[model samples]
Target: MEENRKYPRVRTGYQVRLTHRQYGYWVGSVANMSEGGIFVAELRPSEFTLGLEIDAAILGEGWDKGLPALRMKVIRIEEKGIALAFVEPDYPLWDSGKLSESTQSPNQ
Candidate 1:
């Protein structure tokens, strides 16, 4: 089969937490990521529907400092997980020590 993705995806094992308008919040791990989207592994298919909009924040490592939440739309569903497309073309990834500097209290 020919791959038709605009952005190349890389395999990743990052943890993430997602929030949906109807579903509240849930946790999942990212199986792969691309500039355009991400495949969330281990997410229950029954908990999501195609076209559902959600906000997600990458968890682990630098998350204790701060990570920006991304707005995405559920595009594909499979037996293991769901695919989410980022609402914006450009979304930033968190790096260790980077967030702590920006998220620090002024009083400290």
Candidate 2:
């Protein structure tokens, strides 16, 4: 098959938390990442559906507790995992002020 991805992906081991309004929450590890999207592995396929909007938060060692979750849309599903594309690709992930008011923690 031809590789038609717009952005190149890099392998990663970052832990990620994904939350859905209907499916609850899932914790998985990132398989790879690209500017346009991310692939997360080890999550149950039955919990996701293509085109579903979800929130993703990278759980790094120094991950900011105040940072808002990134909005992503499910684009693909496979045995390995599910692929998600950023809903707002150009959104400033590091700018807490811009997103703080619009998002809240899943725990809340």
Candidate 3:
């Protein structure tokens, strides 16, 4: 398969909380991540649908203490999980802990 992704992905096992206006909340772990998107694993198929808009928050150790919820759009659905792309490319809050060395700002 051809690798045409704009951002390189890092394999990770960070917990994630997914929220939708209609669906409430669903929890899963991040299988991998890139600047553009994330792949969440172990999510129930019935919890999400393709093209759904959602808000996500990364949880657990090493994550930012005040990690802002991210707005994402479902781009792909796999047998085990779903892929979500960030609506905005710039996510300073998402770059905390193991992901990057930048410090979180209060105004973000």
Candidate 4:
């Protein structure tokens, strides 16, 4: 395994999408997230590969705003679903339209 920067990431509860293995699609929630990667939960480990493509969206409330088509890659697989290391994770909270993207897990 490669060395990680060990950046402190914030735990967020957001809706995400991953390609289904058998057919159709599967959904996941953001357990935690950093600029480099995200830990998603409630996913089928069997449906992921070392370099699987994952499409995730930061589901929102009130206004129903989220990120654009996000593209990520699976880098590790823990006890649960594969860990997705975003090849390009862009949570542009700067965009006035995306200002709400940083809302931590509702409980956080």
Backbone clash pairs for candidate 4 read none
58: Cα error in model 2, Å: 0.6
User: What is the RMSD of candidate 1?
Assistant: 7.9
Would you list the rank order by lDDT, best first?
A: 2, 3, 1, 4
**Residue-wise lDDT of candidate 3 within 2-87, one digit each (tens)?**
99889999998798999988879999999999999899998886667788999999987899958679999999988889999988
Worst 10 residues of 3 by lDDT: 93-102
Model 3 earns a TM-score of 0.77
Which candidate has the top score in TM-score?
3
lDDT of 2 by residue, 1-108 (tens): 999989999988688999988778999989999999899998887788999999999887766878889999999999889999989756554776666734968675
> Stretches of candidate 4 above 4 Å error?
1-5, 20-23, 62-66, 88-108
Provide the TM-score for each candidate, comma-separated. 0.74, 0.74, 0.77, 0.64
lDDT of each: 0.85, 0.88, 0.86, 0.71
Clashing pairs in 1: none
User: In candidate 1, residue 52 scores what lDDT?
Assistant: 91
Q: Which portions of model 3 miss their true places by more than 4 Å? A: 89-108
Can you write out model 1's per-residue Cα lDDT over 3-108, one digit (the tens) per residue? Answer: 9999999987689889977769989999989999899988788889899989989876644546468899999999999999989646445455675766888887
Q: Is 1 or 2 the stronger prediction by lDDT? A: 2
Residue 67 C-alpha lDDT in model 1: 47
Per-residue CA lDDT of model 4 for 1-108, tens digit only, reads 976667777877676776534556778877888888888888877767788776656664532564465678888887676678767536653655554746745674
